[model samples]
Structures are given as structure tokens and as C-alpha cells.
Target: MSQPPENFAASIKDFESWPENLVHQTTCLGVLKAHKTRLDVTEPKLFTQEAEDINVSFLELIESGPTFDNLEVSDDEELQQRLGEASRRGEDPKCRFIFIGAGSPQAPLKISRKMLVRVLSYYQVIPGYVDRLLEFDGRGYARKDMYSGFLSQTLLNHTPTMEVDYLGRSGRQLQLCYNLRSIGRTKRNHLAPCHKQWSFRHGAFHHQFDILKGTAVWITTTADLDLKKRIEKSTGKTGMREDRQFQTPEQCLKSSLTVHLLLCDWAYENLRVYFLWLDGTVEDEMYLLVHNRRIHEEYPQIYSLGDLEALRNLQEQTKGALQVLKGNIGVFSGLRDFYHGLGENDGFSLRDSCIGDISSFTRQIDNIIDETKRYLAQGQLIAKIIDARETIIFQHFQSQATEKTEQLTTNMQRHSLTVRIIVFLISIYLPATFASTIFSIDVFKYQDQDPISTSNASDPIKQLVSIPAIALDRWLQVTLPMTCLTFAAAGLWLWREDRKLRREYQTTPICTN
Candidate 1:
């Protein structure tokens, strides 16, 4: 057989809209549907037909009586009048309403603020026909385009009103605005920055939402029962007593059934009004399962960041913070008690946090200031030491440079004096050479050459040769020995002078001046 395309609209109409009456009783409200809802139907006959789809068995049980006892209001004449009118219109006053739901049990059930907020977001029912119901004409539910959180408007934009008997006060009506806005803001602030991460550090009930009942509600595990009870007491004193409580792990499981329930009952009342306005028959059409699944999957993740480990770690941090806060309270309490009992002067050491090591509250600030001054004094001392070391090193380098400069100057002066002495010796040798050349030029001319020399002179060539020989002999006699002696004396004198100068240098005092 061929199946028709899932015409979601047609398919949706086949099932009933959600059962609003069951909302208070179960974790879910069964789906329901009706064309002319009790609120929508002006005629009495149409209203009866519309409400027939609601659970017949449940309606029979209510009609049978005991359930009505819980709902009857003796003093609420207005509510009684509305009920009579509904009955006269042939509407089944037994429209299956909230009978049961996950409630606070004595067992341990530990729940995160995230989980509670998610649950609240899931049950956000839209009361579409409340304004038309006449007796409960709330202006917020009258708007045709009013959505729960779509189109940038929160439940706050559409203020909801509810009739309730608070404590001893009966028939009093209040808006869920203040509580809803507070919780919504808390959840929004807590989750707004979590898109960038996997875990968030926050206090317990950090993302709490009010259950239309006026207080914040938290469903917790059985293991934390004792702590939760104490927390409730604390909340009462802290002026947050409006927080309601609930239980998780509905069936019997033994991980420790201690649970904490935070009620946003005061604020959540507005949501209840919006939900109440909904025609019981159209429950299926305005079904919120998709919204429920989205909350279950996404809301927790807004704080958890997809990592189980991170989530646990954040939980642990929050728990630790809670413990620290508890300890602080205990300390403060002990201090108060001690002061009250002044006679017991056992001198309890008060450990102040500002000065970590100090145990006396009286001198805490003084100790901190003293420690700061000590640090500054030590820093200045170190700077002084560093400056002194640098000065010493600079003085040592100055002394070394002065000695090197003086040594180089002495070596240059010695080198210059040696060069001048060598030039002077060369000049003396130049004069001696000129004088020897002149003397050797034959002072007696040709007269000294006797017989053989005169005879050889007559023979022109022989005379020339004889004259040259005489000149050579004279030149050798005068110049050769004299040149040798001059050179020998120069060498001996230079050696002796160098030795004497070196000895004088060795004996002389080193010039400090």
C-alpha cells in the first residue's frame, strides 16, 4: 500500500492537543485536539463535544468526587461562579487538569540548575484562548501574535495573570512577570557567554527559572537530601524562600536519593496563566515535544560545552565554592558566638585572609602593609649593591688603561731616540770619508817618485801607471785601517753605550710622575 506524504498539518490535527490539566501531574502533558475549544465555542453544545476527547477515565474519576475536594474553594466565590458557568454551558468541569508530576520526594536526587531551567523551558505552554474565556480575561493572552520566546520577545512581553490562594490569602491574583523575568535573565546571563566554551563556573541555581508558583524549583538527586534541606532553610532566611524543590530518579535507584528542589513559583505563576489560557482541546496542535527535546539536548550544553568531563569539573568547582561559602559562614557564626560568650576568653586566633600568615584579625592590615614595606626596602638594598659592584669594576679598568698608555709612550720615546742616534753616527762617518779622499790625492805631486819613477814618467805610459800605484798605496794606508778602526770603534762604543743605557734604565726609579 502506498502511504500519503506526511502532511504534518493534517497529521497534527488527527492527534489531540496537549492535556493542560495533566501538566501539574506528569513530566509531560498528553497531546490533544479540538476545532472549537471550550474557550473558543460560544455555544454550550459545542463546548461539551470539544472537551469529550480528554481522557474519559480521568474525567470519570474526578466526577466520582475525591479529586474535587482538593480543587473546591469555599471563599473564592468568583472561582465558584466561573465553575458554575462552565457547567451550565455543558462544558465538562472534569476537563482532565494537572493531577500529578515529578514532585519532591524525601530521597536524594541531585539536579543541576541547568536541568531545572531546561524543564521549565520545555513546559512553556501558550494559553491561546484565556482572554476569550471571559471570567479569566488576561490582556497578555489576548494578543493574536503573542509567542512564548519567538520574535525577540520573552514571556515578559506578554504578562500573564493567575488566581491563587497564597498562604492564608485566597482569590488573590498576581502576575508571573517579576519571577519569570528574573529567572529568564539569570538563565540568559549564565548562558549568554557559554557559546564560546564547553563549561561554565557558576553558583548553585545560577541559571534558575521560576516555576509559575512564585519560587525557583530545582530537581536534585537523593544523595544530596540533607544538604538540600539545609539549603532550603538558608534560602528561607535569605529571603529566597520562594524557591520550590523537586525530585529526580522517579523510580527506585540507590545512588543516594538526596535531592534539592528550588522553586521559581512566584515568577512561574505568569507562565501558568499563559498555559491556563490554552483551550484544553488544542493541546496537540500546540504540542511542545520539539521544544522539550531541544531543551533537553541544548540548554544543558549551553553550560556544559559538550564535554562530560568539563561539566563534572564545573560541578565540582561549584560544589567547592559552596563548601567554601559554608565554611565562611561557620567562621562568621563562630565569631559571633564567641563574642556573645565573652567570658570564655580562650583567645581563639582569628586567621585573616588579607594577611595570609597572620592569625590575628586586629593587625591584619598592618601586617600586610609591613610586608609591602619590607619588600620595597629589600629591592632598594639590592640596587645599591649592584651599583657598588659596577663602580668597583669601572675603577679597576681605569687603572689598567692608565698603565698600558704609560708603557706605550715609553717604548715610542726609546724608538725615536735610537733613530736619531743612528742618523748622527752616519753624519760623522760622511766627514771622515771626505777628509781621507783629499789627503790621498798626492801632496808631493811627482817629486816623491825617485829615479825609476822619474824614468818611467819620461816613458809616458809607465809614468802614468807609477803615479796611479802611488795613489792606490796612499789611499789604502790612510783609508783602509782608519775605516776599519772607525767601524770597530763605532761597534764597540754603540755596544758599550747600549749596555750602559740599559743598566741606567734598570737602576733608574720608575716614573710615577
Candidate 2:
């Protein structure tokens, strides 16, 4: 749990008679809730850049950090005590780094560093009222001005070299690890390398640096780099309207530009991964981003951008890269089935469903691309918003598909009783149908008129009139009662069987005492 802010009430406005202070306080509470609820970084330590003068080897960082090295008793104890103290104080630690690993040379050195700052980057977009408090309390100032400025400066200074070799392999691997870790927590720009234009359209910037294995860089950016630092923006110093002037397109562009430099470094690290995944030569030109842009631009024939156009070309030129990846995963899944030798089909249907899911996902990506292009052409704020909505919709669709799949599985497993009931009814109906057919013939009148002949029933007319007529009358009278009795029996049987099945399906032992 996080404590509410002190100046919570001063920030919010327009509460139909609600006190400004109370609204502000509520906003602060919400912000705290959001911050507290964010996903924990699974890797304990957040990798950070070594000091400028100390050029530590990648292996050294990994050995020193929890990622590869065993934790030193001292560090573990110290961290435990610190956490305990913070809990007692009802406060979060300012920041701490703990060393944790030892890995083979092949794995190299990678440091795991965890800090709230990285978490806040995605989590700290406070509500309007909370934002006002952060503004009033100077927390907002620190975040936007000092934080973004420092980050921008660092990134600008170390614009990732276009050359992939400059970024060490250990760093490259860590970049991959971080991405794998972060993608679930945040919106991913996995498509960026394949489609550079995507970044520009969405105002998204991706970083691919590894702090532990290679060099870790902490970078931040503001929507307004210059204006956020202005002396006039202070609570007592300037009016709210005055502050709005600073939040302009130019400011956002400047901030984006600053982050862009850092992104370039990240991209440099990222390119190396694809290069290694592929041979020096890549089949998907989009992957050539691992090569310095200049180099590829110079040698256009050898490399290609893995954008929509490139994807189309690859589809035309050879095997579908997406299909190949899909097929490989499917085959791997089937292999697991083979090993288990489970029930019918060995997840063949599951594989097909998985392929369908992948296809839908790929199509969504294409749709986003198209939507983005349309927005760019229109060049309006509304258009941009529409594009963002489309992105959100794509994400929502994925969520819905997962939910639907779970629901389908639940329904299939739980409906056996219904199926059994249906089967039972059909079986009963088969006998009832035969009885009805026999009762439908004529012959009742002949039997009624001749007593002796009726009793003997040697003649066809007499048999038809007398025997069938009697049988038909009896059947009509008995059929309803028998049907009702059969249905009641079936229902009772099914209920018991359903209970037994349900009990077997459940895992917990029933309590007898």
C-alpha cells in the first residue's frame, strides 16, 4: 500500500461542490494506487551504466550482479535489512542495487538492476488532479525537468553507433533479455526495426541497450524539454494558462528528438540480435536494420527494410518467413504431444488454432500499418487519435481472443452432462417410436363384430381390426405413462452420474469430519 500525497487536495478542480482539496487528495491516492499496482521487474536489479571512468568488462558486471553470480551473504543480508526497515517505516527505499549471479563464460556478465525510476517511466502518468499536485509539490518538476533532461543528455551523448560491433555481444544479449522481460509489461515496438516509420507515426521510441553486459544507459524525455525547465512554470511563479504555452508541438518534437538519439543506440544493440539470428546475410531485408543504416543505404541491393513492402516482396520471392516461424512452433508443439503420447490427434487441432491466432495477429499488424498511413496522410490531431484507438482495438482483440478460447475450453469440459442427457433421450425415443408404429394399423371393428373369430384372429381383416385396435388403444393409454416414467428415471440417473463426474474432476479431497 502507498500513502496518499500531502498536497492531494490542491490539484484537482471542478467538483460539483466537492472541495478542491478533497478532490486533489483523491487524485493523489489514485496515483499512488497505480504506482503500487504496477508489475514488478522480474529481474531484481536494474542495470545501470558504469561510471564514465570505469570501463568494466561485460563478464565482470554479470559476475557482480544477481543475473549470473551467486549473491554475497553481506549483500543479501543488507538488502533484507533494508527491505525490513522500509516496511517498518512504511516507505519505499530510495534506490538500491543488489549483485546476484555467476554464469559460464558463454553466458557472459549481465547485471540485473531494479529501480522505481524505470517502473515510473511507464506508470507515472498521473490523473489530472494528481498531476497538479505533483506539479505543486515539485515532484512533477523533478520528473519532467531533471529526469527527462538527464536522460536526454545521456542519450544524445551516446547516440548508439550505427555499427553493431561497437555494442558488445554481451550487451546485445542483455538487450534481448530486457525486451523479453519488458514486452509483457509495456506496449512493444517489436515492429519498429521492421518498420522504422512506425516509430515516427506512433511517437514511440525503443531502447535496446544492456546496462550490465554491455553499457547501461538511463535515458528519459519530456513532451517539452525546454519549457519544463523554465523558471516561470513554478506553482507560485506562473498561472496554469501560462504553463500550457510550453506544452507545444515544438517541445514534444524536441523531447522526441532527444529520445530518438537514445533510441538509435538501442537500435544498434537490437540490430546485432537479428544479425546473429540470421547469418551475416538475412533472408528478410527488414532485418538488415542490424547493419548500420548508412551501410545498408549504400548497399541497398544486399539489405532490405522489413517493412510492409519488404514483407510483400518476401511473400512473392520465397518461403513466408512468418509461415516458417509459425510452422516450426506448431511442429515443436506436436513433438511434445508425441513424447506424451496423449489422447486423440495429439494437439493437431491446437496447432491449427495456434496458427490461426498467429495469422490474425499478423493481419492486425498490417491493419495498424494501414491505419497509421491513413492518419499520416490526414495529418490532424483527430486522425492521430483515431490511429491510437485502432492500436488499442488491436490489443483489445487479442485479449478477447484469449478470453474466448478459455471460455470455449470451459464449456467443452463442463457440458458432458448435457450431452449424456441428449443421448439418453434418443435411446428411449427409439423404443417409443417402434411401439407407436405398431399401434397405428386398422383392425379394431372386425374384432368387435365377431367374438369367436376375434379370439382366434386367423383372418388378416379380423386381426387388423381386433388385435391392432386393442393393442393401439392399450399403447395410447400406456405410452404417456411409460414415457413419463422413463424420462424421470433418465433424469435421476443423469443427475447422479453428473455428480460423480464432477467429483472425479475436482482435485480436492472431500472433508469427512
**Predicted model with the maximum lDDT:** 2
Stretch of 10 with least lDDT, candidate 2: 176-185
In TM-score terms, which candidate is top? 2
Candidate 2, residues 51-146: lDDT per residue as tens digits? 221111111122123221112222223334533443354432111222222221112112222222222221122122122111111121112121
How accurate locally, in lDDT, is each candidate?
0.30, 0.30
* Count of clashing pairs, candidate 2: 32
Give the TM-score of each candidate. Answer: 0.19, 0.20
Model 2: residues >4 Å from true position, as ranges? Answer: 1-192, 195-458, 468-478, 489-513
lDDT of 1 by residue, 1-513 (tens): 222223322322332332243122223333222312443343332112222121111111122232222232212233335334433443222212111111122211122212212222222223322221221112211122211210110221212221112211111111111101111112233542212112111111211122222222122211112323443343333423222111211110100111111222211222222222212212221122112225235441121223223323333322332232232233233322322232233321111211222223223323333433443343344334334433443444455556776898799679858865885676567546765668657663535547777666668777556655665676668666666666676777767877887897789775432
Estimate the lDDT of model 2.
Answer: 0.30
Cα lDDT for residue 38, model 1? 44
Name the TM-score of candidate 2.
0.20
